[model samples]
Target chain A: MIDLLYFAWVRERIGLPRERVETGAATVAELVEELRAREERYALAFADLSSLRVALDQELAEFDAPLAGVREVAFFPPMTGG
Target chain B: MRVLVQAAPFDFGAEAQAFADGAAGAGAIVTFTGLVRDLSGALTAMEIEHYPGMTERAIAAIAEEARQRWHLIDALAIHRHGRLRPAEPIMMVATAAVHRAEAFAAAEFLMDYLKSRAPFWKKEVTAQGADWVAARDADEAALGRW
Candidate 1:
């Protein structure tokens, strides 16, 4: 089980902030693809990866990075907080 | 070091006084407060959103980096989340150092880092609808130069 968090417009699009997701994937990109396949909301939320940022275990990472042992994955729009 | 991320607005004068209350060694206290601008009142309101745990972690990291860069005695950063109207105070940074230069520099540095590095997004509610302010390339460039 992995905790997936969404923020900003991503949260609005996904209609959630966090969720316990079950996935059989080796990389963050695969997980994203799996999510995108689940529903239209996920599709829209993950549609534009260029404008989104990802974090694995609270460290910034690219979507293609391996997620073999990662416990958490967070997706959010371009960080506007300062 | 005190780092706060909340949805409710904060009191600047009170926060500043509390930080400098009993610190006799500190010779200078510098502070910066960011308010929601009118911008022609085009934006009647704004909603600030942020990731929960991640938001706090990012702000803490920025504060830690600032402390390492400057000779800071005490530092504080408070940012509000959720919905806010125009002219509201969005954020505040306070730095105390032995000299004015260090205090000023650290405070400014913290603000700059927070603006670019922090994981917060704002959506302006105007007459039409909600719009996310595009992350300024200039802001990102500013962060890179630091």
Candidate 2:
């Protein structure tokens, strides 16, 4: 099992801050697709990948990044930090 | 270099003084503090959320970059997460160098990186409702300069 985390609006939509997911996906994009199929909230939150950012194992990564040994994944909207 | 990510409010004056005092070999010290702007009085409060482990790591990486590009004696970055009010200090970056130009440039570089690359999100709450502040394209473009 891997840890899946959400922040900001993604957290609001998914209604959970974090979860343990057991998946067979090979890439982050495939994992996202798996999540989208699980619930409508995930589908809605992930409708637009351009507006979202993803982190794999605490590092920023692309959707097509390999998830073979990744332990944690976080999804969130574009950061507005200062 | 030092990076602090906390939820409690920080004292800008004391922190600035401390940073300045600790830079023994520096001739110039610069500090920049970001305040919550409540323009038009529509904003009641601001809520900042951040990724726990990534927040500190991202900030430290930015500080490291600044140190490499400039002749800095020391540098510190402090950012707060959670509820903040209008005019409250949201974050501060302090840089010390042998000259004013290096200090100023490093501080600006740190600010630009913090605004774009850091994994922090802010939401503005007003009497009408609340909304997540959109990330400005200008911020992303600003990073390309360095």
Candidate 3:
């Protein structure tokens, strides 16, 4: 099982902050595809991939990055920190 | 180096003094504080959200990079999350080095990275409603200079 987390508008849209899901997806992109196909809310939150950012196990990563030993995945828009 | 991600307010004056005092050999210290902007007078508060585990890790990495690149004697960053009233301080960064030039440059570098690279999101709350603050292209561009 992989832990999925969301923040900001993504969390608002998804209606929850975190969840555990069991999946066989090989990469972050595949995992996203699986999520987008699960329901309308997921589809809407991930409608535009270009506007989103992803992190694997607390580190920023690319969509195509493999998720072999990854345990946590976060999805959110570009950060406005400082 | 010290990185603090907290929900409570911090004393900037005291933090700067402590950081400076800790760096006995340092000749220069630069500190920058960021406050929530009211702008049009409609903003009631600013809500900041951050990834818990990632926030600290990301900041420590940034601070370490600054320390190595500038050969800083010491550095400190404090960022506040949760609801913040207009004009309230949102965050602060301080850098100490052997000279003024290095201290100033490192502080700027830390600010630039913290703006875009850190994992914090901000929302502006006005009397009318609350809205997420979109990331600006200029902020992303600022990173290119470094």
Candidate 4:
């Protein structure tokens, strides 16, 4: 199980802040592909990988990175915190 | 103690005092408070939106990364969400270390990471309409240099 989080327009597109996802994917890219396959909403949210940032297990990572042993994956627009 | 995310405005003096008050044998406390500037030539009220739980976790990770990369004794990062007025405090970072160099360097590092790595997004509302501002190349370059 992994806690998937969405922020900003991604959250608006998915209509969810967070969700518990069960997956058998081997990499972050595969997981995103699975999510995109689920519905048009997910497809729209994950359409452009360049516009989004990903964190695995609370650490920033590339989309193609492996997801093994990861407990959390968060997706958000490029940060504007500071 | 290391991270806090909220929508309410924060008092800089009080927060710095509190952080300094909690420090143990620290000689320097460097703080950075970012204000909502009416972007040069732009008049807009910005609204910051964020993922509740994930935002905190991402910032904590950035703080932890800063701790690992610097000689720091303590660090605190607090950011505001929701609507914010021009010139209001948007975020603050305090880094306490044994000397001024570490404190200052860590403070800068923290802000750089916070700007590029955190999960908060901002939308500027002007007389025209609300438009979400995308991340700039400068921010990416800042993160890259680290």
DockQ of each: 0.71, 0.90, 0.96, 0.64
Q: Which ten residues in a row have the lowest lDDT in candidate 4 chain A?
A: A51-60
Model 1: CA > 4 A from native: none
Better of 2 and 3 by TM-score: 3
Question: Model 2 over residues A1-82: C-alpha lDDT tens digits?
Answer: 9999999999999999999989999999999999999989999999999999999999999999999999999999888888
Better of 2 and 3 by lDDT: 3
Q: Pick the DockQ winner.
A: 3
Each prediction's TM-score versus the true structure: 0.92, 0.98, 0.99, 0.82
Could you arrange the candidates by DockQ from highest to lowest?
Answer: 3, 2, 1, 4
Model 2: lDDT of residue B122? 97
Worst 10 residues of 4 chain B by lDDT: B37-46
What tens-digit string does per-residue lDDT give for candidate 1 at A1-82? 9999888788889998899989998998899899999999999999989988899988789988999889989998767755
lDDT of 2 by residue, B1-146 (tens): 87999999999999999898899999999999999998878899999999999999999998998998897999999999999999999999999999999999999999999998899999999999999999999999999998
Fnat of every candidate, listed in order: 0.72, 0.87, 1.00, 0.83
Q: Which candidate number would show the highest lDDT if scored against the true structure?
A: 3
Docking class for candidate 2: high
**Clashes per model (N, Cα, C within 3 A):** 3, 0, 0, 0
Error of 1 at A36 (Å): 2.2
Q: Give lDDT tens digits, candidate 4, residues A2-69.
A: 98988788888999988998999999899999999999999999999998888887677999899888
Q: lDDT (0-100) at residue A22 of candidate 2?
A: 96
TM-score of chain A of each: 0.95, 0.98, 0.98, 0.95
Q: Lowest-lDDT window of 10 residues in candidate 1 chain B? A: B137-146
